[model samples]
Target chain A: MPTMFEKIWNRHRVLEREDGQTLLYVDRHLLHDGTAPAFEMLRARGAKLRAPDRAFATPDHYMPTDTRRVAEIANPELREMVASLTRNAAQEGFTLFGLDDARQGIVHVVGPEQGISQPGMLIVCGDSHTSTHGALGALAFGIGMTEVAHVLATQCLWQRKPRAMRITLEGRLGPGVTAKDMILHIIARIGTAGATGHVIEYAGPAVRALSMEARLTLCNMSIEAGARAGMVAPDETTFAYLQGRPYAPADWDRAVEGWRALRSDDDAVFDAEVTLDAAEIAPTVTWGTSPQEAIAVDGLVPDPAAEPDAARRAELTAMLDYMALHPGQALEGLAVDRVFIGSCTNGRLEDLRAAAAIAQGRRVADGLRAWVVPGSAPVKRAAEEEGLHRIFLDAGFEWREAGCSMCLGTNGEIGAPGERIAATSNRNFRGRQGPGVRTHLMSPAMAAAAAVTGRITDIRTL
Target chain B: MERFRPVRSIAVPFARDNIDTDQILPARFLHLPRDADHGACLFRDLRGAPDFPLDRPQWQGARIALGGRNFACGSSRENAVWAMHGHGFRAVIAPSFGDIFAQNGLKNGLLPVRLPEATVAAMIARAEAEPSAELTVDLQAQQVIDADGVAHPFEIDPFARRCLLEGIDELAFTLSHEEEIAAFERRIGRENS
Candidate 1:
């Protein structure tokens, strides 16, 4: 018996090179503005996409989240980048969710939302977060522009088989602990590079019980753990989610029958295994520049002197200096200048509802800024229909349009230099949110709590 | 892409771990036109800070880079690799790399060498202390000759090694077997339809 990863990998193996690398066929190719360069590279080489129908492009990364006309874009480079993607998509004849498309969103979010990503399929994209698609039981991975060009030229990629690892979660999640917390806890236990060279299969009761959207959030950060991809078995939960998606098959019963066969064998073996008790997990937050530097929201900041690893101790010292913090200090009353509750990581409808629940009666603190950018237009429309936007607005939070806003510092939204932010997006690296801006990673509810209190407070305690 | 072979050049020591792609080339600069030279944007943010290692006069014109584990971590933007290559870096010696960055380097003719953690650390320290420090990385020999006359072995996928040595990009390599790929696509398309 083989693991689900192995089964999928074996099925997609197209050609085995003499040097041990295998050329795997790609079923779905997701593209974005970042892929514009690959398209240009292909054009320069006089190449054409092998199967344009299999490829989909969307202009999301560089697009502005604010309601701005094309003429109002201040950055000429951003305008050109967006224009280039539009030009290339039209030239290449690939389906694109342009700026006006209702489906427009982050590539990872749109892929699953529209059902372009399917169970038992191989998906590749130029963006690293493409692993989000693996929640549907697909073997999905990210590739660089060079590899993107290769895939476009020929719908196949040369890859070395990654080892298999299984992480099982038992027990049940406590109140205030979300899927984001589970992933943060995992990264904290196993440093950021813990699972390098392996594809992880999340099994056991805790994972199987997660909704498809939650599973997508878990798999979205697999790359942060240095894993090639993360996946969960496609069961009834997955089938139900995909049942009415736009790109999903019309024959729902037949589609489910195929998806049901995409699970790992009962006796499947993995190269490595880890088990975690979900009961002990708490609302988590990152205290340093790296994802692995996370601790419970109520936990004290680490004391560098207590660190045994000399290199890590120095790194921690530098991190503390950069974050303007000290050892043994609790993050509880740490003042925050801003709060952001969106990104592909936590911008889904459920995430919005969780934050809205906390903000229903509370108002954002004076002198603090907050923004909630939905994951996609559909997510935005759904949130508005449910009056999630009104709840946030009434609570003094600014509800913005959909895009990767404030998550990466590339867009118009940014934190001022030397300011601290409580963000629900992934990554807290130096200047990740903007130059000299410190970002603290948390869940949507935690970020909402921070917005209302103007500090990093435990959501459960709120 | 240029062909890879054995050569010796000055090495810039950036001992930091987890040097993510965002730091390599920030997203703010990613929107630059394709015609723009990526080397100009390499470490643009870090270069502005006075203490960044790349600002040291010692590393001026260095053709090789030395860093710790998980170098080029995060994001699949190939520009990270191109930025290094554009800045005259022919090879990056690290304990580990983000998978996509390493693959991107291979096709772009930038050699990514993975040596033991201890060996990489020692090499970086030596390179930093001696500005004129140079290393000869021989693909054929599968070893990097240190300034002190010690040869440190490194590992690379055999297929990638052959491609780099032959100056064969993935596009060229894949196109060589166009007939077979086309046949396979036709078969799959027919079955699915």
Candidate 2:
């Protein structure tokens, strides 16, 4: 028997050329400013967009949401990239949620909220976090600008069939454990590249128990574990989550019936299976370079000298040198200069709530520049309504507008080079935070903790 | 302007898995418009260091890429596929692949093949032991035959397999069957049908 992923990939496999690849029709294409310029070139050449109606775009990167600092966007290069998004969106006829639109947010968040993401649909976005929409039971994957152009030009994409991998999280999560912890734990065990080249279909008891938001977080990090995409088979939990959202179809009973059938069959075969015991997952924080080079909150820093492989030594050594940390120095008590809590990874409204819940009435450490940016305008609004923003602001943290602020230092929202920051976004590759900036990846809750303590501290404690 | 293909069988081993399109060609390289040779950037960010075993004198002229599952993890960037094709890689061997990579690979006449983990592990172990070792991916047989004559049957989507066998991408195949596709479209175009 085939899994849901296989069924979808095969169902859309329209034409098989002699090369043995299938032409699959793309249902929806989502893109952002950071990955939209090349598509603009196609328009210049007079190539008609293959499926213009199926694509939607938004301006996330390089869109300075902070009104106060808008004037500080002095760099002319970044300014042009921001305008290119609005310009291309206008010229290409894509439905664009530009910066002044109330609906504008991160493309991933906007897709689901707008009901554009649905079960059994094949969705492609230029951004990596496109996996977030899989919470609606859609087959979503991140595409590149070139592929984005191809999809834009042809409305169809050529894709090869993939073997299925299932990651099963058994048992229930412990108190204070979140989907963020579950993925971090997976990366820790498997290393960063454990599930490379496979579609990770999340399964098991713990996964079934997670909320749609939590499931999105899990799939969101599927990239972290080296999986091409991570998804959960839609179930009652999925249906319940999509019931009354702004875009989920009404007459939910009918929707639920379709969703119920989205599960893999009993005898379905998978290429690989990785099991995670959810109870063992603790709050995760990355002290080293990659999202995979992470440890639990209670874990100690990794010792580079003890590393077995030369490659491991180099990676660990590079991270140590860049971050300017010594081996055997505890991850705790490592002072931070800044804390950032936003990204497609963990900038959701609930993520802010989780952070604010811990930050209520607590003040950020003196001299620490802590900030929170929601993933979408809607998330920002929701956080304000829930007083999550107020909690963050009251704690002396900067409450800023949405867009990928401080995530990549795009839009002039940056950490001064060499500043140590506890960031909540995915990827801590060398120079990923900013030129010469050191970023330690952590959960939103952990970032909040770091802000309050000015150091890497366990969220469970604070 | 066209992607290069190996005359015979070649094996290129990329050790990294889940290499998103972004990493294949960094955002810096993305500044160059598409169709400008972005091939050199393929696997550029994933170098295994000067002394790493996988970073070999042997990996210099190989074609078959033995990779981990979810080999292409992030971004929907077509450059990932463009980079792979430009890198002279005709086939990718892994336990699995990213949906977009699989799609993009097939689109550009590159084979993204998935085998059982046990089979993939054996292939990886062999390639690591002898970086120069070549693996034969017989699309007709659907088997990855390593240099030592070890053969392992790998599963592929029949459609994708057909495209690779015929050297055509998905779009070309669809255009070839335009009449049938048109009829099917007309039949299903009605909402109430």
Q: Assess candidate 1 and give its lDDT.
A: 0.87
User: How many clashing pairs per prediction, in order?
Assistant: 0, 49
Compose the digit string of candidate 1's lDDT tens values, residues B64-163: 8998899988888888887898888888999999888888898888899999999999998898788798899999788999998899888888878887
Most TM-score-accurate candidate: 1
Best by DockQ: 1
- Local accuracy of candidate 1 as per-residue lDDT tens digits, A1-462: 988898889878778898889988899999987677788788888999889999998767777888635556678877777778888888888999987888988888899999999999999998888888999999999998888988999899999999999999998889999989999999999878888898988888989888999999899888888889999999889988987899997777877887787788899989999999998999999999888889999899999999999888878898998899988889998999999999989999999999999999999999999999999989999999999999999999999877787988565577888999999888888888887899999999999999999999998889
Kindly provide the TM-score obtained by chain B of candidate 1 when compared with the true chain B: 0.93
Q: Supply the TM-score of chain A against the true chain A for every candidate structure.
A: 0.98, 0.95
Going through the candidates in order, what fraction of the true interface contacts does each contain?
Answer: 0.59, 0.25
Residue A330, model 1: Cα distance from true site in angstroms:
0.7
TM-score of chain B of each: 0.93, 0.79
lDDT of 2 at A9: 80
